[model samples]
Target: MKKISPKELHERMQGEEKVLLLDVRVEEKYNEYHIEDSQVLCLNIPKTVIFNLEERDELAQITKEQPIVVTCTTGNSATKCADILDGLGYQVEVLEGGLTAWNEYRK
Candidate 1:
């Protein structure tokens, strides 16, 4: 999976880029604040235990060829999500350092 810094991701978002920015943090955290156009998909729950994987259906909405970037509080959760997506044959990337880095660099 490709890895990108938050600053670079922010710049891409500013431009006319068709990118899927995913925030893997919790819903409450996301409700507090998140980058523009970012979709929330928390990875705190165990993927194996969560049978209704298609609950959100965001994965189905997006094509595997699309540029998907995952982000969490500190990038670990996002990395895990990226791995799962990658294994499923999706073109995914992880935002290095995640939202923390983004907040530090951009805000």
Candidate 2:
């Protein structure tokens, strides 16, 4: 899976790129804070629940061929998610250091 730093992702978003930004952190943590326009799909949840083929198809509603950027609290879970999506033939990228990195960028 490809990995991108939070700074690069931030710039991409600022440019109004039609990206599929996914927040793979837990719901509570996501509620506390997340990058604008990111959709939350907690990594702790079972993959069967979130990444089923049907679910992925549904997720494609937002951006079928667009770039997908996955993020978690750090970067591990998001990378895993990217691998899954990659295996499914989607273009996916992981946000390096995840939301922690994004938060740091904001400061």
Candidate 3:
């Protein structure tokens, strides 16, 4: 799997590039705070769902058209999710250090 830093993600958003963010965090956590921007399409699918569900319909909003960047509270869960996406033939990247790093970078 590939990896992307919070700085790089921020730069991409600033450049007006479309970003597909797959947040593997729980829905409540995602609703509280997440990467938001006009260029970003963020999906809040819990890590457990991604691990337990076989239906891709829940992930229908996301496509193989763009590279996906998965994130969680930390990098661990996102890494697992990225691996699953990679196995499923999608180009995926883990958000290095996840949202914690992102929050720090934003400061």
Candidate 4:
């Protein structure tokens, strides 16, 4: 797994890179605000409960080879989810500073 800064993420998106931008923040927060209109698809799977059987089962739909970038409110939770996904043989990256950094970078 790798850590990508929000600015780097923005640049990648601008370049139309294919990535799976996974938002690990809770659904409510995700609904309230999120990264909009990027080259990648953004899916919300709250980190707090991702380890649950249902969540992991739902995530099984994503292919193993897909490049996935996980984000949370502050980046800590993203790291955890990244580790989980990496252990499961998925290519994973952590969004440095998470959505907070993403919002700051957009500004």
Candidate 5:
């Protein structure tokens, strides 16, 4: 799967490039922290749900028009989620190093 660095994502959002973020972390973790910006639309769908979901409509929040960045606490789960999204035909990329890397990048 493709990967996007936090710096690249931050630049894209800052440039007003609309982005869709599929955060595969649990809702509680997602609520604790997540990417937020005017140009970003984030969706909190746990990795477990994405793995077991059968109906496509359940993922209606995602669209093919925009490239999606999948994220988790670490990059592992996001990579798995990206593979699933790829199979489902979504334009997907994983956030490299996931949110941990992002936090470090910001620091």
Candidate 6:
């Protein structure tokens, strides 16, 4: 599994990197707060458990080669999802410290 810092992600997005931000929190949490920027596209795929196949299959609609960044409240859930996606041959990176890290960085 791969990991990326929130600051680096923001820098990359600022540079116009086409990265996918996959938020694994529940719908309510995702709606509450998330990384919002024009340069990066973000999608919410709630994961009640680690690597739900249904969600994974649904995400298959997107190209596998896309730079995918997985995030959650504390970064724990994203790890599981990242591991699963990596095993499936998708290049997945976890948001270091997850949303907390992002929130702090923005502050």
Model-by-model lDDT, in order?
0.70, 0.69, 0.88, 0.85, 0.89, 0.84
lDDT of 5 by residue, 1-107 (tens): 89999999898888756789999998999999998888999998888888887744558877776689999998999999899889988999999999999999999
Q: Give candidate 5 regions above 4 Å deviation.
A: none
- How many residue pairs clash in all the candidates, one count each? 0, 0, 0, 0, 0, 0
Instruction: Give the lowest summed-lDDT range of ten residues in model 1.
Output: 41-50
**Candidate 4, residue 35: how far the Cα is off, in Å:** 0.6
lDDT string for model 3 (9-83, tens) is 998888766888999998889999998889998988888877875656687777776799999998999999888
Order the candidates by lDDT, highest first. Answer: 5, 3, 4, 6, 1, 2
Flag regions of model 6 displaced more than 4 Å: none
Model 3, TM vs. native: 0.92
Considering TM-score, which of the candidate structures 4 and 5 is the better prediction for this target? 5
In lDDT terms, how accurate is model 2? 0.69
Pull out the clashing pairs in model 1: none
Error of 3 at 32 (Å): 1.0
lDDT, residue 93, candidate 3: 89
Please estimate how well model 6 matches the true structure, expressed as its whole-model Cα lDDT. 0.84
Residue pairs in steric clash, candidate 6? none
Using all chains and alpha carbons, the TM-scores for the candidates as numbered come to 0.77, 0.75, 0.92, 0.90, 0.92, 0.90
**Can you tell me which runs of candidate 3 are displaced by over 4 Å?**
none
Show model 2 residue runs off by greater than 4 Å. Answer: 37-48, 51-63
Which candidate do you rate higher for lDDT, 1 or 3?
3
